[model samples]
Target: MAPTIPGFDYQRVQVADGIALNTAVGGSGSPIVLLHGFPQTHLMWRHVAAALAADHTVICPDLRGYGASDKPADPDGVSYAKRTMAADVVALARALGHERFALAGHDRGALVAMRAGLDHPAAITLLACLDVLPTLDMWQVLRGTSATVGFHLYLMAQPPGLPEQLIAAAPDAFFGHFLDIWSQRPEAITPDVRAAYLDACRAAVPSIVADYRASAGIDVAHDQADRDAGNQLRMPVTVLQQDWGALLGFDARALWSAWAPDLAHTTVNCGHFMAEEAPEQITAELRKLMAR
Candidate 1:
């Protein structure tokens, strides 16, 4: 059986036609939806969600292509675009009886949250992105050797055929590589959790590739159009990142400022998986954001 968040009830929620998200809903106060990133599921929010559940209705959902969620085939990558994924999130929240809610996302889910904040601004009361920049800013910062660490981004961004085949052949190793490298506290992801992530990724290879491919193609276009139109996230936005901007020699705050006029950006000391490694800090920050 898949591991579950303690005290949380699991359900398969239909966010769109033929696309039902595997979701966990818990707690009782105002709603706050959390979106998980790549190589993992809503399970990544195990620690933080439990804490947030005390004072908020914490909703955790596996993004469309990951975990126990339905993985719709997207040959042209449109269905998996962050815009589409963001829509899934909005729809999920509404179905769960929340017309407006606080939103938080980690990694790829952060991309989805960012898009949602822009496209569905009225629906998201506040936005918190765990460890990512805007899609356009993310692509802009990828230059020279700094981009090497993000090799997987380029690898999976390729056309459907080969990337799917390659990842399918060694899904565990590929997925495990991120879990090993991206966490400051490797122990946070126990053996069971690691195995669950690998198993999910292994089963959803094609849709997973489509998710990344969309980031490279259609997602970027949506971001560019938003940027060109002078659109900004109107809601309060907070970003927590690993100081990659300082190491990569770009102003992280400056890049995020363009998109989030009312923004609070912080460079965290923990690794990319902040929620797991520093659950208390993440929970505190999230509560602070929601209160704002």
Candidate 2:
């Protein structure tokens, strides 16, 4: 079973766009929104959220498609764009009575958080991204051998139906591969936790595919436009990433610095799932960022 974090309560809140998002909220001070990555839910933040709850209101939400949130049918062209998803986070926080809040996201959530900071700078007081670069930078950096390391991206980026169908056929193996490979310490993800992740992915295939599909298309367009406009995150931005691209001969900090002008890029010794693999270190970085 996944290790339980004490004192956190789960609840659902209705946002303006007719979507009801299941959110796990705890603590009681300035609001800090925590967004989870792909194949996981608000539950991924369970350990780290409790630590933040002591001095801040930590709000963790399963981004629209991945967890207990309303999983709607994917529209023909535009539904799963990260920009649109970012808007959901914005409205959800406002509905929860936070006009201005700090934002943080991991993996897929990190993409949405990037959009939130870019599109709604006035609303986000601080921005923290865990283990990902901007989508455009990611695509630009993809090369021969380095690209192979992230084969899942290409698999998911395929033209719709194929990925969903194949993944649906063997959901456990499909999602479990990421859980096994991304973590340096596989023992951290107990069998039950793996099962829960597989279950979430099995139920969320179409939406998840739509998310990746959008990333390959519209999401790329949006990021490119931001680059063209010379836009950078105006708020204090912190990024933590493992050395995935270092082997590809790219400097992670230099690439990230190009996108986020007010940025503090650092290397964390954890694996891809930094929050889960090293919750204490993740929590410590979060505390330090909050202080700034």
Candidate 3:
């Protein structure tokens, strides 16, 4: 059986025609939906969700193309677009009876949340993004040797067939690479959680690759259009990120501020998997964000 969030009830909710998200809903009161990052399932929020559940209705979902969620074939390039995934998130919340809710996402899910904040501004009352830059700023800042840190981003962004075949041949090693190294507190994931993540990623290789490919192409274009139009997040936004800016040669605050006028950007010391490595800190940060 897949490892799950303690005290959380799991269900499959239809977010789009023929696409239902595997979601875990817990707690009570105001709603806050947490979206998981790449190489992870909703289980990544195991610690934070439980804490937030105390005073809020916490929703966690395996995004389409990841975990137990439906992975529809992406024949058209836009299928796995962040816009599409953002729409899935909005739909998931609406299906769960939340017309407006707080939103938080880690990594790839953060990208989707960012898009949702721009596209469906009125629906998201508060926004929190964990450890990532908006797509357009991300591409703009990654340059020279500093860019080597994101080799997987470029690898998966390649044309469809090759990326899928290469990753499928060694799914464990490929997905495990991220799960193994991205955390300072590796023990936070535990063995069962690691197994669950690898299993999910292995089973959803094609769709996962398509999702990354979309980030490189259509996702970037969408962000650019939003930027060109002077659009910004309409809600109170909080960003908890590793201090990767100096290494990558860019100011995370400046980049994020361009998009979020009411922003709380913090430089965290935890590893890439901050939600797991520093759940206490993250949980505190999230509570602070929601309180705003």
* Root-mean-square deviation of every model: 0.8, 1.5, 0.7
TM-score for candidate 3, residues paired by index: 0.99
Please report, in order, the local distance difference test score of every candidate based on alpha carbons.
0.91, 0.86, 0.94
lDDT of 1 by residue, 146-227 (tens): 7898898899899878998988888888989999998889998888888899999999999888998888899999999998
Model 2 segments more than 4 A misplaced: 1-5
Cα lDDT of candidate 3 equals 0.94
Clashing residue pairs, backbone N/CA/C < 3 A, model 2: none
TM-score per candidate: 0.98, 0.96, 0.99
Question: Model 1, 5: alpha-carbon shift in Å?
Answer: 0.3
Write candidate 2's Cα lDDT for 83-200 as tens digits: 8889889998998899999999999999999999999999999999999878988888888876888788888899868889899999888888888788998876667666777777
TM-score, predicted candidate 1 vs. hidden true structure: 0.98
Lowest lDDT 10-mer window, candidate 1? 243-252
Candidate 2, residue 74: lDDT: 72
Clashes of each: 0, 0, 0
Q: Candidate 1: how many backbone clashes?
A: 0
Worst 10 residues of 3 by lDDT: 179-188
Candidate 3 residue pairs in backbone clash: none
